[model samples]
Target: MVTASSLGLTERQAVILTVGFYMITALIMVSCNKWALNTIELPWLLLWCQMMIAVILLKVTHSTGMLKMPEIRIDVSKALAPLIAINVLGLGVNTLCLVYVDTSFYQIARGLVLPFTVIFAYALLGQPSSSLVLASCFTVFCGFYTGISTEVNVSQRGVFFGIFSSITTSLHAIVIKKSLPAVNNSSLDLVYYNNVLSMLVTTPIVFLSGETSKVMATLETEGFQAFHSFLAAAFVTGIFGFLVNLAGFMQISKTSPTTHMISGAVRGVLQTLLGYFAFGDIITTGRLSGIVLILSGGAIYTYAKDKEMQTTTKPTYIPMTQQDVDGNEDNERKA
Candidate 1:
């Protein structure tokens, strides 16, 4: 069987893979969501579809034995309620941001997520951060202000939605740590529950939003091409959406919240650059500076965290086998 031990991989390798999975999936999911939302003009319904599609895909994967679904339990569902609530709200604002903001501006719009996460963590979880981490958050806040001040095409509503998302996101990250225990610390189970509950909540949201009516009206007035495009984009994003969910939990399980924030900062940089090329987004000096400062803060934060971990970490002892002892004794006599 394939395993990390057989491949001689350290924890760092696993960290890289987990971070990579999130970065790549997030980048794709955001772009696809932007397309799907634009083409459909029904954010709630589109999100509902994505959630349902993700659940279906999960079920299919479970059937194939690639992953097993935990049986539905009332206790687990109740424990997951808080997470599901935040997940729905967070995603709702995120889709709204995509609807109203430029692809490149997306990162700047949501840039406060890290700082907010730090603040929420300390306030709610009673986890204190180092001085350097606090300084990094200050730097990131500066970058956020810089970009917002200089951007001429900034969307006021998009910024509002982004701020709301930051709040939900901070809460979501903290809540996940608490909720994971209820799922036996299994990322897959959490993913399953999150999507399933989201579907239940979003079903009514779609109708209450009047999005279903809008979709049907548009379909009757427009050709099939746009509808087909929406479907395709939704499917692609739905798959990555599930993968990103799994990746998020897997990463949170293995890394500190600080490290996860750093990875997200890295992702923001890459996402900004890609959005520039993919969407032909206008890049200004101020915007570029914001990206730089954000990335620099993430670097500083990561270094401080590494240094802290090294000092606080205890070393492990590996016992040698009898064969190794006999060989060492013979070598000592020869010497």
Candidate 2:
């Protein structure tokens, strides 16, 4: 069992605390992004700003020497090129979806990620999945259709961006897996390197999107006060953006992977409710039913995957590095 050694908390206490914080950070990141983009009207610029803040936080955290952060080098750039491209695309599309969609409809919009992920895994990695997984994907598909069909004032552009984001998200997961070798298989390093590369890509886009003109217009119309308000919102969103990743990492380290995934399902439910109360988002019967179906499918998929892992007699990947070997030992010990 994982313990909060510094806090001297028992395993259950630690798990609850860690998972709760992880869920909260995830929720805040979404809500903050929605709030920031609501008035900003500049998705590319906001993305650039958030990535910049995340990069700064990562550098500071890496420099503190408290955590074992991988030393980023230039050599890995080529290896991470594909992932970087997908990361930028994914972030851009997700931001666009946030800009165009309501907070309550967000999950249903991205509900296709599971199906896309399963499809990509099979296509790219030649991995075989069980029938339960396919059934769950079908359920997710139904949920997405149910939600969109019932929206009284749905944004077609938002739905398009959302679907594109789902594809990128699923593609990104596979790309990240394949690119892990470039970062010494350290997820922390991947986050650091991804932000750095994504920033390089988004900086020019910020200007290309005419965000500078928008900024100037706002300043001229509302003065520095309005500009400062936007900045404050972006700053808060950026902090949560980075913290959400750290929270997820901490949750995984402090509990089993199963627990982490399960918490995500719960977090989605809470996010739906949070959107309804916090943002005056309408929760129609169809929307609510769609969300329930999606969540149910996701939870079942997670369970099926976990059971598949437990019953499988063979390991998937060959251990290439000492790190991989040690990780294998640790996983076995935990089990």
Candidate 3:
């Protein structure tokens, strides 16, 4: 869609096109088959698919550049190995968790990843928490409570799966954040490598878990509907998923963890709306209440962070040499 058309673009217009890409992909996927679509695994799978495609497209676009390619100092193997391990473990658990939890409930519960990231930061990075951060954390807890209250069937396993997903996601985030310094990786490269590694790891599981057989069954029984979902899923990962990661990585780190946490609340709202409008899924009273708390907290978090950023000085990226594209490394500073 718009994203595909805007490939290689890095402008405000490109960003808008990217949003259009996601909306179209979402609409198409949800409209094709809600039951099958909802049952599909985490969008991470699609993320990897997009990485593989992007790599191919990049190669095609830069065939001449490939011949004269700069010898990037990165150890692709080393960087990818740990990322793949964490991502596969996280995504595997997430995929299984999806089977046991409804999408809306899962969305609400996943907001807890924000708190988990703070905990992970404290534990892994020795990051100290201030009173303001502590207060924000408390707010997040309250928000989570309000959000999950409306979810149906409060089973123990459901709770376990949600918690597990949060922990893995938090760990994955920390791992990526820590790796950020040494590699000074682009979000595209980070995603591409992780996806490549995860796909390598997950391909075997796809066979072992009988996912392959299930996919075949889906094709045999559901025909074009199944095909459409498959294509939609692939497109989502290839295009929209990449943009989402890029935007979040670029934006979220600039804000406080609490602000990021509050914004995390919006996934449930967006997903619930998509479910209802696109698939005729019921918008329950509880979900409506949860959306309100989520939005309120997010608004508070954004307002606070905007005020905070206004008081700080951070350099905005100015395109320089090829080495300075990201402006995140010694090379960029040297240049």
Per-model C-alpha lDDT, please?
0.76, 0.76, 0.53
Q: Candidate 1 or 3, higher TM-score?
A: 1
Per-residue lDDT over 1-335 for candidate 3, one digit per residue giving the tens place of the 0 to 100 score? 12322466544444344344444444333232234346464344443465566455544545765422223344765755666687777655654555555555556555566567667878876765545555555566676676667666655566677778778877765566555544444544554455455656766665777666766777788766756665665765555444454444433222223323444454456666766665565656775665565455445545554554455455422322222343243212110
Sorted on lDDT, best first, the list reads: 1, 2, 3
Q: What lDDT tens digits, residue by residue, belong to model 1 across residues 67-123?
A: 889888998899899999999999999999889987878788888887898788779
TM-scores for all predictions: 0.88, 0.84, 0.66
Question: 127-235, model 2: which lDDT tens digit per residue?
Answer: 7779998898888889999999999989999999989988986776457556767766566777788788889988888888888998889889988888666688889
Q: How far in Å is the alpha carbon of 146 misplaced in model 1?
A: 0.7
Deviating ranges (above 4 Å) for candidate 2: 1-21, 62-64, 67-72, 247-265, 317-335
Assess candidate 1 and give its TM-score to the true structure.
0.88
For model 3, which pairs clash?
A: 46-237, 50-238
Arranged by TM-score, best first? 1, 2, 3
Model 2 residue 194 lDDT score: 78
lDDT of 2 at 64: 90
Shift of residue 141 alpha carbon in model 2, Å: 0.4
Off by over 4 Å in 1: 1-3, 6-8, 310-335
Q: What is the lDDT of residue 116 in candidate 3?
A: 77
